[model samples]
Target: MQTAGDETVITVYIGLGSNLAEPAMQVRRACEALGQLPESRLLACSSLYSSPPMGPPDQPDYINAVAALETTLSPHDLLAELQAIEQAQGRVRERRWGARTLDLDLLLYGDRQIDDQQLTVPHVGLPERAFVLYPLQEIAPTLVIPGQGPLADLVTRCPENGLQRYE
Candidate 1:
C-alpha cells in the first residue's frame, strides 16, 4: 500500500466477464462503474476479449477484460464494492461458473496474498485462465502475481484457449 497523507492506497486488478445480456457492453459499462467507485480511481482497462466458456460447454462464449484500480479501500472493502457492481449489473449466483450477466473478480490487491473465505487475491484461477491473463498482460504486462511469479511467464505458459481480442 502506498501512503497518500494518512490514507493507504493499493493498486488492484479486477477481472470482468459476462456471457449474458450483451457481454461486451456489460464489461465496458462495468469498467465505467469501477471508475466511479468511492475511494478508488480506475487506472487502466484492457481491450475486450472473447473466449470460450471455462465452465459448461453449453453456455455462450464470454467477454472478458481486466481493470487496474488504485484504491484506498481495504481488500475486503474493495471486494464488497466489486460484488456490488456485479449485482448492480444483474449478476446472479445460480451455479458455480455458470453464465452470468456480469462477473467481477478481485484478481489482485496490491502485492498482498489473501486467502480468506470471502475472497482470494491473485484469484484462485489466475495462473491458468487465459482470458484473465491475456487482458491482464495488456494492462500490466510487468505485474508479478503475489504468489504466482511474473505475468509474462504465466502468459507464455497459458495457451490462448480460443481467446481472442474483440475487434
Candidate 2:
C-alpha cells in the first residue's frame, strides 16, 4: 500500500526450496537470483532447513528457507517476477508438489490479502507449513499471521515431524 512519494519501502517475504539436484546449491543460487530482480533488495535469508517431502513422500527431501525483501513491485508483479526466477532456474511444474530445481513461493506481500488463480497473499498454507513458518520466524519473529495471531504462537502449535534446520 505504499505510494510513489513515500520514502518507506514495501517489505515482502518469500519462501524458497529445492530438492531436485544439489538442493543446497540450488537454494543458494535462488537467493542470489532473487536479489538481482529489478527494484528488489534481499533483506534477510533464513538458514537452510531440510524437510521431508510434503506430498508423494517418495520424493527426495527438500532444502528450504525464507527470505525477506524490500521491493516496490505490486504483489502480482512480484509474483510474476518470482515465477520468472523459478523458470530461469529450470523449474518444471509437471507434478503437484513434485521435485524441482527451484521452488519460490510468495509467502507474504506487505500484509496484503489477495486471492487469484495465480497467487494468494500471505500464502494459503503459511499457518500450517513449518518450513515456511520457521524460517519466517527467524527473520520476523513478531510478525502476526494476519488471521492466525502471533507467528511464534502458531509455530508452537505446528507439528515438528518433518522439519529440521540444516545447521
Candidate 3:
C-alpha cells in the first residue's frame, strides 16, 4: 500500500485486453469502473486495436487498448481494484495468456519503479508487446519506459504482426 506523499494525485497508464464475450464491451465497462473509483479519474484512452494472441497460438484474437488515469490510490490499491473488475467480469486465471473476459495491467505509475512478487510498475514486458505499446503510443507518445527509451521508439521495434487499429 504505497501512498503518494501529502495525498498528491499520481498519473498512471493501464493496459486492457480481452478475447472473450464481447471484449470491446468488457473493456468499456472496465473503463467505467475505473472512473467509479473514489480517487481516480479516467484521463485518456487509446483507440482499440485488434491483435492475435501473444502466447499459445490456439486462442481467439484480442481487443486491446491503453488508458491514462489520475488517481490518489497507490499502485497496489489500483491493482486490487482492477482485479475486482476482472472478477466481476468472470475472469479466471487458468493459464498464461489464456482467453479471458478482462485483463488489466498497470503499465506505468508516474515514473515510479516497483518490484514486488504481485506487481511490477512500468510493467516488465510492456516494451515488447505491441498490444500494449501501440495503443500506449497513441495516448502517450512521449512516455519513457524507465530503462528503455521513448514509447514511440519501442512501438516501432515491436515485432507483433497483424495488429490493426480498430475503426
Candidate 4:
C-alpha cells in the first residue's frame, strides 16, 4: 500500500458488466463513475468488450470492461461503493448471473487475498473467465493475481469463448 499523505492507498481493479438498459452505455457510464469515487482515482480502463453470457443463455449479450484504481477506501467500503453503483443502475439480485443494468465486481485489492463472506479479492473466477481476464490484461499487463499466477499466462490459457472487443 502506498501512502497518500497520511492515508493509505491500495491499487484496485474493478470488473464491469451490463446486459440490460443499453449495456454499452451502462458500462461507459459506470466507468466514468469509478473516477468519481471518494479517495480514489481511476488510473486506467480497458476497452469495452462484448461477451456471451455466463449464465442463462437467453439473456442479451453483455458489455464488459475492467477498471484500475488507486484508492484509500477499505475493501468492504469499496465493495459497498460498487454495490451502490449497481443498485443505482437498477440491479436486482434475482438469480445468479441474471440480467442486470450493471454489475461491478471488486476484482483485486492490492494483492490482498480475501475470502470473507462479503468480498473476495482476486475474484474467485478471475483466472478462468475470459471476459474478466482479457480486459484485465489490457489494463494491467504486468499484474500478478495474488494467489494465482501472472495475468499474461492466464490470458494465454483461457479460451476466447466468443469474447471480443466492442466496436
Global CA lDDT of candidate 1, please?
Answer: 0.94
C-alpha positional error of residue 39 in candidate 2 after TM-score superposition, expressed in Å: 1.2
- CA RMSD for every model? 0.8, 1.7, 2.5, 0.7
Q: How much does candidate 1 score in TM-score?
A: 0.98
Q: Tens digit of lDDT per residue, candidate 1, span 1-167?
A: 68878998999999999999999999999999999999999999999999999998889999999999999998988888989999999999999989999999999999989897998777999999999999999999898988779999999999998999997
lDDT of 4 by residue, 116-148 (tens): 889878899988899999999998999998988
Model 1 residue pairs with clashes: none
In candidate 4, position 104 carries an lDDT of 98
Give the deviation of candidate 1 from the true structure as CA RMSD: 0.8
Candidate 3 has a TM-score of 0.93
TM-scores, all models, native as reference:
0.98, 0.94, 0.93, 0.98
Candidate 3 vs candidate 4: which has greater lDDT? 4
What is the C-alpha lDDT profile of model 2 across 1-167, one tens digit per residue? Answer: 45556544678999999999799998999899889988788999999999999888889999999999998887888888999989988999989998999999998877678888988877888888999998899999999876667999989988876788996
Runs in model 1 deviating more than 4 A are none
Which ranges of candidate 2 are over 4 A from the true structure? 1-8
